[model samples]
Target: MRGPARASYRPVTQRLEVTFLPGLGEIVADEIVERLAPARPPRPVPGREDALLVDHAGRLERALSLRTAVAVFLVLTFDVPRPKSLTSGEHLPRIADAMATSVRLGAARTFRFEAAGHDSSVFQRLAAELAHATGLVHDDAEGEVVVRFRRTPRNAPQPGATRAPTDQAGWDVLVRLGGRPLSARPWRVADFPGAVNATIAAAIVRLVGTQADDRVANLMCGSGTLLIERLLAGPAATAVGVDIDPDAVRATQENLVAAGCAGRATVTRADVTAAGGSWRDAGPFDLVLADPPWGALHGSHVTNPALHADLLRVAHEVGAPGAHLVVLTHEIKVMERCIREADAHWRVRAELRVFAKGHHPRIYVLEHV
Candidate 1:
């Protein structure tokens, strides 16, 4: 006689909402699969591709380590007809539990609601209830934990749908785990006028693929974003950044020490476009990263094409045969012209266009031939 099969009991899977820049959802998903290796690879939320729903169990400390994520939230779904129902129903305890988990895992002390129309009385009422239930102060100004409520987008209307005209479901309560957004790099002590986002920089490094013994170089390294991200991504044989601006050089130097990237990289005040600079002969680099000004902020458009041409010459001089050059820029026409002009020396390999807020920046991977 065979014994009856025992039913295996599994705990509830914690759903994490990992948000990033709009165009980077796919990259962020791949990173989660590589780093976290969750039970199932993360899937993008419907109608909100910028955010992914990650199913992870138990503690959430490891999930917060994702460099490409802007913020990680512990999501809880509540079935209430109206927003006001949450203030009276069984949702308070559940929210308190989520808050406890967030505080425990993230070591947070305060909480705040990050929602549109947050100044409305409904949000204020909900905030008051959460403070009472969680025993945590609700500090709107400097709160460490951010709680957000979003409606789950459904294709079809539910049997008892009562809200808006479009199909809608219950509220998804998202409690952010950390004191600050992950995009705010701790090592960024200095700021550049048009500095690229840290998460985008991380994505660039990931897409380029790092090697242990690769020699890395950054031209026009404003605020050292690409250099620091590369050093953090993996072990490099040697890394160096050069900029004509003394302030940029100083900022990079400051960030190098702050980021614990001192032994891995060096920063110098030298013109990358000039053939006579000391940094010109220090190359034969395996990887070259560039984030040049796009005429809008730092450099003007009138001379940008010539400047980009000079940049190509400098990279060609220092790059090893078949070396890869990864470039991020918004000056599309100028870069297109320069790449065409330098066709004999370089060839385009891959290109990815990503959105950062309202700005559209294109990333190009080129091979020095």
Candidate 2:
């Protein structure tokens, strides 16, 4: 049997758009610069929230491998007066050419569009034209080439006034470049109820600034996201995950093995709140990581403070002096109070607010004082 074809971004030197989880622009840019070097750094797109622009001149596979962003789009713009015009102009051929360059779209048997009033006659006509032009079936709901069509912003507008439409500065058509979204991680073999998104996990790992020789501990490690991302991000002297639930422990172990980092990491079925010496057998860690239960899914508001405090106790017990404690959670006040009261043992270093799955969460970075 033969394997699937590999994606070759035949064209170099193109302007790409990036839409990422909010509050992660700088981190995403850093991820890009660090991996795809000499390609200009990702810069925030004006008037667009959670969007960035990158002028890339390298293989497209490198961009598709980016972990921190939600989607990367090959940009196409037209100055036509209305949506219908997109079907008639030189735009049609250009759109087809752009689609041909994308490995997903070129090989797809069908295509689809995401746009305002997609069911309208204009869009229906446009879809028909594109199908004829590209010889791909139009399967509105299940198209492999997911097209996002919107009005390119002409200017910053007043609050109540509607922003300009396609009749203004024309339309922008974006085709996602990756064969699949980056967050749809293939290594996720098991899932937990409160498991973090892979992109968020990648961001959290990047925030810690992984090093080659650091010893790491993941507390309350539900699915071993931090542990897997930690080991994948860079080399670590030792990495272990501890959880109170045997189910969670198993989930972490399964995911670690799927990620192919099991040999370099360990998952323990132990309560983090227990005496540090119990698990401290591995020695003090350079970084302690956690994504504790928030009120919604894994825990309740009434008990989070104590839970947060216990997590702190475990961090103090396991972390070496000046080691870092990175926690990602939505239980802000309770977590803040715990850290504030434990001021003698910790210092707040940074706070990052991010959006995911219709909820806002903050990552707190602290130092073991």
For each candidate, what TM-score against the reference? Answer: 0.91, 0.89
Q: How much lDDT does each candidate structure score?
A: 0.86, 0.83
List pairs with backbone clashes in candidate 1. none
* Whole-model lDDT, model 1: 0.86
Instruction: Compose the digit string of candidate 2's lDDT tens values, residues 95-198.
Output: 87766666552336677888989889988998898888888788898887778887776564545767633325777889877456777777888999889888
Candidate 1: tens digits of C-alpha lDDT, residues 1-369: 999999997856788999999888878999999887889889777666588989987458888889999989888887776667778757888888888878886546798887777768998898898888888888887788788877766653445767534777788888888777899999999888888899999999998899998989999999999999999988998898999899888988888899999887878898788657767566789999999988877988888888888888888889999899999988887898899999999999988888887999898899999
Residue 207's C-alpha lDDT in candidate 1?
84
Given candidate 2, what's the lDDT at residue 41? 66
* Residue ranges of candidate 2 with Cα displaced over 4 Å: 1-11, 37-41, 104-108, 157-168, 276-278
Q: Give model 1 RMSD, 1 decimal.
A: 4.3
Q: Evaluate model 2: give its lDDT.
A: 0.83
